[model samples]
Target: MSAATPTAPWTRTRLRTSPGTATALFLLVLLTACLAAAFPRAVDRYEDRGLRRTLAAEAPARLTVDVTVEDPGLELTPEQRTVRVSDPVTHAAYRKIAASLKAPLTADPHESSYGTRSAEPMPALDRWLPRIDGPPTQLTLNAQGGLADHARITSGRLPHGDYTARTMEAAVTRDTARHLRLAPGKVVHFPDLDGRPISVRITGVVDPVRPSGAYWSTAPLLRTPEQRSTESQPPTHYWTAALLLNPKAAAAILYTTGRAQSYWQLAPTTDTLTARQLPDVTRSLASIANGPGLLSVRTATASDTADVGSHLGDVLDRYTELRSGITPVVSVAAYGTGAVACVVLLMAGGLAADRRRAELALLRSRGASLRGIGGRLLAETAVVALPAGALGLLLALAAVPYGRVLPPVLAATAVVLLACATLPLRAMAAHRRPHPHGAA
Candidate 1:
């Protein structure tokens, strides 16, 4: 064979040299840091809606309504009738009675006593009450905010004076059929303020009431069923009204003024007792049994009660201090861990560097300059670390949502590793001191 060809060190050695090992270590550290930075952004994104709502509701407002029931204690009458028009017990009597008949229709002319108890053939009527004689009476409010300025009609208002009926009138939705165990065509009864019986035809059905444990009004009708006879119906009662205000004004109003008589603060952070419990407490205080004095005034907005600006400020202030405290501790821990990893890596790189030093010196002794050595080191590092750091970042982005606690740290680490991989290879290469002996 011809004299053994001198292979160039760069061509001889693969990418797994001193520069490559240093680059790998740098990338690993960078992955740890990148994840740390992204965590807060994710958290803030999730809470943004809640924050805006709270800000709106907490600004301040008021609502006041007085409720009065015509008869809290109603007596069951002997003429308990079902919606069936064919039954002799109800239909015969309805046809025979005068156009304007008064109360106390008997169950039967011969039957002496009333028995609400269920018989073997049929269960007791779902509810035991006096039978309504005829169709419902109705009052169609021509004006918006019919009785109260803030009253909202949820459903069932046909044009004013739509029907003329001998019996009292009331409105019913398809859902009312289910509630009273009647079909769409069947009639159901309601008592007017004058205690005259009225019945409603099932008109329509829309969105059902809110689920039991939710905040907000869920009653189906805008106005309670109205009796058909204008002369017999009582003046409409005001049940509730929602007051509107600017968010800033609403925030202060919770503490300062509310015709509502009571309110309470809701916690803004997690989904829990704060939203459900505060509204419950406010309502409870306003209940007939509980005096309004027991009520604690509260803020109400269409938005989340917790997202009030003050609540967010409180959360941010606490989080800032907590994050401030945690960042230093984490930083120190990361630095210490990185230093240890770097030390371990340096030993390996140093060993690899040492093995190449003689060959490197021989080159330096010739035409090769120190800058050439540094360039070679950088080239080697890039070959190893660049892909590793990039791969780590790709993996991090993929794994962001699934990560438990260290997403932010992982992100920060990625940046750190990239910085090290790209900039420090030359520095590491320049660190070598001159060897005292001649080139090996």
Candidate 2:
């Protein structure tokens, strides 16, 4: 029988020969890969946390779209001119404007409030005592969309539909009622520009469930009365408040006042927002403000002069500025850490290469080709680096899973490739130099 063929030394045996070096190299590679995979994800988490905090603390008015159209009644068609203010056709026109204003908002968990208010304040007078005149008050006829949801009736009940009646039903806040000494069943009158007295009967007193809530921000004056004084020998104190009226009375208020301002408040919930959606939200807000969305709303409502106002863009801009200020600092820190990691990795690789130099030289002397020796070194390093890198990446993902996958994947791949290439390149360089004893 032929002699058993001699087999080359196993790769496992070579690795087992220097268990300490292998363990150290594996640990170094694992740490580097873990940091590479974790940095971006950590940054993303930090940014998301900051974004949520900023949004939660911001006022509702800064993040809502407030659309206002003045004197919608003046845009009535010739055929619509003869219709009564309480007619369904007239109500439909105002509803159409509200629908147009709400059409552009596509964000989830959003709320809207639309109403008509007299453009100018009228002096409020008690019907029973004509001599006592109180502060100026504005009449606002609003749909019960989110009003009842955010306010609680303390005295009577929500205003009922009395659009066709001579006196419209209204509700006043607890503060307003107290300040004006008004209560349920009290009759209040305001003289319209047409010289006719517009009468309203208070049906209830309301208190806000959450005074600081976004819903209240839509109509601040309704919850908190405004106080103003003129500069004179004795400053005359003036209080302004808004009286909430049934939605059905919108056309009557507009018609009686001759000109009224209509408002649509669109408030998007901050809880539904994410850092990834920042750019999209900003663009959507901008589109609603001046782009095709605004044009479409104007065209649909047939109100060419309607104006859309929002501070959402400005809020997003502040966020961008904050991010920009922080990004460079984070980049510099990452670069510094990466440079230090590279230096440490290079030192470790150099040590490992130095340790294997004698073995490599001995193989070269035994007629092994330089390519063969370099290939063995590369294979050994890859055996340790690739799996360690993968495990590190898995650990990072399990810890903080928030950022784009591509960046972390590329970082781990680059680290593994560098680890694989380092040993072979260093070995090849050391072998190429001329030996003083002319050996191998």
Candidate 3:
């Protein structure tokens, strides 16, 4: 009988012989630690804009756009000074633009009422009138900031229809109504800028916003000295009471007042817009800006601006930036560390396994089955990898925010197993167990 060959312990014996193999496993754990350290910051930067859960939940943002006064010198009609964006011509133009872009547009616009306040006081009743400063102002609610949609009416019904110049009804804020002691169904008289008598019956009251509970202005009702030119003298004008009217009514008021005294609000149809579509929107609005009697429109809307529209390039740009943003140095460090670790593990494992070919050959000669040898080697790999994975996880927790844990540990284990498993295959492939005397 051939001499009984001792069974080479696949795991313990292999490790005892090749201590250097641990270096590859240690390097994998170190790389995993590096990934863990950088992961939180990377994720945080991504979440800022890439996936906006907040925006999805909130209503679409609206922008305020001030219609710049073109002929501050000429006493032009509001219809003349400002293009009626809600009119058929402008609406059709926007529709064409929308159709061309294949985008949904919210046609609702907030056209401001441009009439002057009725300077004449109410008929004397008692001494129950609240003290009010500044001139009374008339303003119309356009598509963007309509009374029925945004405001809460504390009393009475809101004025119906597209605020026609003919609908002699008006909605006042709670503060304005309280100040004038005006109630629903009360007829109020006011003079247009041309001193034309305009009588509008109070229809409802809008709830004031917040702790002050005061409705100051339908829009900014203050006029400073600089707003005046040689044509517009007595520059300082104040608006104490604001009347909210629809576009048609506002146009009527504007016609009576003979001035474009307010801004237009603009917004896209959808709640959100993408960066790719901004250029088309900007161009579409450019057509309107070039229309008759309208001044050049601004490309970007500011926070204070009343309209958010014409394709929402600014908002889209912000979201795009968030999605694409990367941590400049950390991104490279984390990825590079992982790739290098993989390469190192594979090379070191192969070398260590090559050295253990003799041990595998000895096991084979001892009648140890291939399945048994593979099992032992695989178990040995798990033993090293599992502990290294745990250690890597601990290191990661200490280094980075606690938001992450499992990914690094799992990654470390996977890397170690891959490296260790590859070793056995390379060793088996290269090994040649010499046939014993008289054995095939």
Per-model root-mean-square deviation over C-alphas: 20.3, 4.3, 11.0
CA lDDT, every model vs. true structure:
0.33, 0.71, 0.47
Per-residue lDDT over 196-301 for candidate 3, one digit per residue giving the tens place of the 0 to 100 score = 5566677887773421211123233211101111224554443244555543344444434434333333333433443344455455554444431132233211
Q: List, residue by residue over 131-230, the lDDT tens digit for candidate 1.
A: 2333222112111111212222245432222222223222232333233333333444434334443343433232323212111211112222212222
**Residue 84, candidate 2: how far off, in angstroms?**
13
The numbered model that scores best in lDDT is 2
User: Which has the better TM-score: candidate 1, or candidate 2?
Assistant: 2
Error of 3 at 203 (Å): 1.3
Predicted candidate 2 versus true structure: per-residue lDDT over 275-350, tens digit per residue: 7778777777767688876886566445788788888778778888999999999999999999998888888878
365 Cα displacement, candidate 3 (Å): 12
Off by over 4 Å in 3: 1-45, 49-146, 161-167, 175-195, 208-237, 240-242, 246-254, 258-326, 336-355, 359-440
- Per-residue error at 245 for model 1, in Å? 20
Looking at candidate 2, the ten consecutive residues that score lowest on lDDT are 126-135
Top TM-score hit: 2
